[model samples]
Target: MKRILTIVLLTISITVSAQTLRKYSNEFMNIGVDAAALGMANAVTAYSNDVNSGYWNPAGLVNLEDNQLALMHSSYFANIANYDYLAFAMPLDNRSAVGISLIRFAVDDILNTTQLIDAEGNINYDRISLFSTADYGVTFSYARKLPIPGFNYGINAKVIRRVIGKFASSWGFGLDAAIQFETRNEWKIGLMARDITTTFNAWAIDKDEFATVQNAVENQNQELPESTELTIPKLQFGVAKKFIYRHDFSILTELDLNIRFEQNNDIISTSIASINPAFGFEVGYIDMIYLRGGVGNFQNELQIDNSEKIGFQPSIGVGFKYSGIQVDYAFTDIGDQSVALYSNVFSLKLDFSIFR
Candidate 1:
């Protein structure tokens, strides 16, 4: 046991000393778009049962029995930014399903102060402009339950686009795959591979489009023309269980771990880290009303320094389901000591079985 503990400690130390967070393009892809999932700190990979599952775990789309549509919107940091998502799913048969989804994250109407002055150093407030930065994605998802009663597989093909104030833009593509298993006794397991083919973004900047403004503003940095960025593949595993105490009362609990492989400058060789572990629970009453809570990013010991707390986000939410409609609301704190940040998310879902 002592030897094992020593090895474990050494691995963690090596990991911490070797890796630094690398910047990636289209970071909005990492944001959780589903209110229910985010409310549970994204531990729903194994408990996916709704249309939003198209984004969380495509295999979960097999759980849908009706044509479903879901919409969600979130306001972050007191309305500093907005994130929205929409998804629709339909069952093609008893064992197959397909889904389509869209994501938009944006910060609009920001003042462009870089060109506020003329070349002769005269104040030109009229030269100031307003612009928006936005990221978008369209996803096509397909899921199927194998001949085996409890096994399912799914895939997602996604197209990504990002615009930065009309000065720069990017286009990218990626794929994700997932598998899930369930038993008669309410135990579930899931695995997901995100960006399985290595999502790549090819950026094209029209620097000449801003040439007039650049000439008007002195000492402004020149924009680059083209570049490419690759998003490394990520793997996640989850397990969940449901406990039923009464016909109408039950609780669901889940745990998830995320792993990412990236270039590590601090260590001689590439290091592996199971960095983000999340825990969540849901209490349901009659399947009509629900309460949810979760905590994530508690990687205190995994950090290289005392001041850098990589994890520590907590969230809570509530939901109501009646007839064929479901409504949910969630609150999450994503703050640090210097910046107090919080987000509120709301979602609505409708299910209708026209073919049934």
Candidate 2:
């Protein structure tokens, strides 16, 4: 059984190529959490004020005036994958705040091949199995207003776990830091460092489990061994401003720059790459409803092949607020229309202070 599982997982891992200069493992962490942010092409680093801040820019948590909770769910990768996020934040004091967040990405109902064949090499419907591949993360965040009036600083400590249908698993640890500054003229600037300590994922595979399907494992030429994947540091810088037309209307615009560094095989030379530049815009009506649109993921080539071509991923979203409850919806084109790669995300947020 373990052998069969190993082969399946190995086959999946083999699909990834070192085709991009910005190569980092566990890319799932890069996925945006709430519909509000995704709708804005992930340009919310400077303007994040909701529970989603726990994931985007922890410094924004200081903007929370009351205890709040947020939940999000999205059908991704043409409905083949599911992503879910949850977060809660509360003010620790006038100048400080704390938050907790959880994320889970999963693909389920995968066929269990080990049980698919009968003893005589014949297929038996009863001998079937199903499993899932998932990634999970939990984060704790702290934010405090700085002595510099409109400035704030924050940090996030997180643990990550990945599992491959009882075949392989990994544990990782990382830290993130952020700072935000609000200018007198409605402009906001934010800087964030992700995995500053260099996150590491230590993977473990159960070889003993493979004994059940020894022949299958032997043919794959895979020597089961413990290994680790490292994710280097990344930086994000953003600026946002709101143009208020009237007491009842305003437009918010934002831009974000993502910089990543990678080391060469010799470990002597390092290179920096700008992974993507994101842009977002939102229009609000009396603070009750919002319309958003944005584009991101600018690159010369979409993939390894030069002919693939690259184009911005565009997204649109709508949000409404009633009392202490807010609801948001987003429609995103995940690129490559031929593969049916679009997605929809929905999120709900609640402010407990309304009850008080």
Candidate 3:
């Protein structure tokens, strides 16, 4: 069963040429990192002020008060795939900060069935082998407070790596830019530009491995795939405000607009661009315990009757903080509103100052 599934996946991948520009290249990077953000349906652009900012909006890294480390893990597709993240951030003087983050998503133990049948037409289960497909991303971020008070800017340089067993691999690079501003009234605004320079991935396929599959299945995969994948720029704008009551209880509300250059099934779609809006809020008591909820991923879905229906994803989460250590958990979908099962995400953050 595993062998059959692997072959089907491989064949589908082989059908795409390298020259074609894919609309959803490097999609693994978009899965998000922190549980707090995921629980809020990824609406954290304006107030992500911690180690995870390296992946959200780097400009928020400037708000880090102490050296911090973060880790996260989540499973998807009924545990067939695993996603993990790690990050560290530190303040450089009082006005500048730097951070590094690493992310990985992988599916392991896929059976390679190209050699399941022997050359003499004999069935041989021993010839089957296992392999894995994985994607990795590493990002370095730097943020600084602008000369103007309450203003900050940041930049990120990212490297992307992907491998499908020993059959194919790719290396890609990209950049991100972001800015944040706070008003005297305590309203926060942020903008993030992903793939600001247009990321590119150069794929290299192992012809020998590919040939084995080609010989196994006739009239398919006859041509080698030589491809460079391109990812166009995307923008996210967000605004947030925090309301405090009784000096001990607070509520933070945030709204984000995710914009893509091409038209799609987003709520607001046009020839020039598409916009998907997300809204989230967090209720906190004494800054130690919190509850969060959000709605996002708005799309127009075609029902069985060929009628368009608006669909959205809703998520909820909880968080706890004590002595500079924070733990968060979220129950949410993996950005696909069609998926019936939601994923459980957990993350931990530690501030170095706790030891001091």
Clash totals in order: 1, 2, 1
For candidate 1, the 10 contiguous residues with the lowest summed lDDT are: 13-22
In model 2, where is the ten-residue run with the lowest total lDDT? 14-23
Candidate No. with top lDDT: 3
Which residue runs does candidate 3 get wrong by more than 4 Å? 14-19, 334-337
Candidate 2 residue lDDT tens string, 12-119: 552231112223777888888989899998999999987889899999998889999999999887688999999999999989999999999999987765555656
lDDT of 1 by residue, 170-260 (tens): 7889999999999888699999899999888777766674554444334434554466777788887999999987789989999998767
What value does the lDDT take at residue 110 in candidate 1?
Answer: 66
After best superposition, candidate 2 residue 229: deviation in angstroms? Answer: 0.9
**What is the alpha-carbon lDDT for the whole of candidate 3?**
0.90
**Candidate 3 similarity to native, TM-score:** 0.96
- How does model 1 score by TM-score? 0.85
At residue 277, what lDDT does model 3 achieve?
97
Residue-level lDDT of model 3, residues 311-347, one tens digit each, is 9998899999999999999999645675546899999
| RMSD of candidate 2 to true structure, Å | 4.5
lDDT of all predictions: 0.77, 0.81, 0.90
